[model samples]
Target: MTCMQLLLYSYPYVTRFDLRRLMGQKIKLTKSTIDKLPIPQMGARVDYFDTDCKGFGIRVSSNSRRFFVLKRVKGKLTRVMLKPYGVITPEQARVEANKAISKLYDGIDINAEKAKDNLKGMTLADALKKYFETKTLKPRTVENYGDLFRLYLDDWLHKPISGITKEMVATRHLNISNQNRKAAANNVMRTLRAVYNFANELHDDTLPPNPVKRLSNTGQWNKIERRQTVIPAKQLPQVFQAIQKLENPVIRDYILLLLFTGARRREMACLRWESVDLEAKIFTLMVTKNGKPLILPMSNFIYDIFNKRKALRENDYVFPGHGKTEHLIDSRKQVNAITQITAVEFTLHDLRRTFASNISGTVVGGYELKRLLNHSFGNDDVTAGYVIHSIEKLRIIMQEATDHLLMLCTAGKKINE
Candidate 1:
């Protein structure tokens, strides 16, 4: 077989040999002498130690023989693979092994140090699998990891975790940001950061430190703009009227409820019938992104919307998807259709912004607005501790917001006198 084909067929099988079967029989090592030696039994390895070099040895299996150094540190034994036989002369192994053994004598753990260096060959994709095996993550967070690693950053999966340079990460982040969006780039790098950190802990000293850190260290991480788009006050009536014209009650009520409550799209999409308390006018999210379950007061309008959705419910999910994800996947097209009809260009999140804006300075205090939005203003604000509002107080605030939205929805429609 050709040299390239020989390596291609044998490399994987050679790496699988149980080198631990090494019996450590000492021999006076030489290149010609080692070459003349017989191969061991299939799947097993035998160690031929050198009498002249204390830690120097050669491991021979059926497929290949390799030179290695072994040392005992802190009462634990470790082996460091050096070079494959035929690639390195026995004299070369002897000289290299002497230097490594001297370090062991000086109390340095050469094998452990070598182990750290082995991390340089481990790919980012391998680290992700190892991280998943070691950590328990939220399902949504797990999904995000899959998206970042497998979908978005697939090109980098095979690259060594330790080999990813700071320049590579920075330029890649910038490229992804330009090609996709800033948020996508940020999230991709954030997941890369997590996977890189796990691999660093796994390899410790051997691999190069995380390249993702350069973004933070140099303050070059993209400062993403917080979108503040909202349907204008004058456009609310036009928007609501367009929503009213939609044929599907599912999409209609879905858009209306979002405008009224300002709950995130995924939060609303994942809602279940059991979480809704119609009589109490409250929606309970048993598990939320922040791990805090929301017992949010729903205004009469949202309560009425839920009542309609409940009757149409064919599944546990509030907005059950027809395809693989099994939840309302993307409402971008539905939202864009509404935008077209009303000439009010808006995102689903804009409905959230609209809810907050319409209710602010109109029906309740700023703190109450934050409460209605289920927002946690930073803990740095001392008065945030004392501004807690009860459900009854929040209910009053929610009712006012609901009533105001209704007026906007019906503003220009005159009743027959």
Candidate 2:
């Protein structure tokens, strides 16, 4: 038997010193000693300890040799790699080993200390960049977050996230609210809260509690009511007449489609020809705000609009634009023009509200209305889960609603004539 094997057999409970001696010769680990050490066989390693410094050693393996420091940390022996043999001289390794041993004796966790340092150094901008990298947010949501930071938190970008205090958050919220941008203030705080919470979770909870929580605790958050604006049914004809006179055919059709389908502006604006079915008399939205695809039966008016757009199709988009997206974006100028001419003040979303308000009780049931709007039933509405409204049924309801709207428009046109 080999001498090392016999020694292992004799001493069942071998100490690290005994193991080190069995593995390699005990010597002062100078550059000369490290260079003279024999490399172990393939798949084997030999650890040579320095007699001059306790727990300082050089590990020789088939591949390479590296310097390391060994210490008992929290009752467990831990070996921390310092540098490869050629990367640092023997004197440099000794200096690093001494520092490492000192830290271990002081009960300082090197890894934990580094993590804390990183957390402390992270700025709001850095946190935001990391948040975007780690999250799977929709493009529009990402863009909106960027816009919020630029508009509201631009000054705070370079500020360390850990340094932001509860008092600072409260003061900022109050100041933004006083500027009459109550909704913007709430949105900014919410965005900051999301980013801070994400960072706190990411850094092993080493960060302080989110400062944005201060707004809620101190009742400093703005109380902005949801807008309930919608076009009065009587004014539908005026709005329609003004929309028809729009010079830009694309914008004119886009606004009409929004009113006809009760679709969000972006949803209708970004429609593709592939999603529209001329024969089926239906249109489908593959990407809706709720993340669910919507297939809605087109009313006669909506079908006609799509047919007209099909004839004028210049690209894949139903309403093609000259921009990078190759789809219609905003039509605020045209909408504002209609509002001015008809004296009917309304936003694009207001048309969506108008469509729902006009047709809710008269044309469809509660669940049917919700389905038409592509809204989630939510967990609270258990009965809604059981209720399934088919496309044909929805088509009938849509037709009835479209007929009513057309009747109003016709009446308004006759009055104007």
Among the numbered candidates, top lDDT falls to 2
Residue-wise lDDT of candidate 1 within 244-332, one digit each (tens)? Answer: 77887777887888888887777777778788888888887664566666678877667777888888887877777788766677777
Write down the lDDT that model 1 would get.
0.78
Whole-model Cα lDDT of every candidate shown, in order: 0.78, 0.85
Model 2 lDDT per residue over 83-149, tens place: 8989999899999999999999988887667667787889999999999999999899999999999
Q: Quote each prediction's TM-score.
A: 0.70, 0.79
Model 1 clashing residue pairs (backbone): 116-206
Q: State, as a TM-score between 0 and 1, how close model 1 is to the true structure.
A: 0.70
Collision count of model 1: 1
**Residue 256 alpha-carbon offset, candidate 1, angstroms:** 0.9
Model 2 quality (TM-score): 0.79
Weakest 10 consecutive residues of candidate 2 by summed lDDT? 3-12
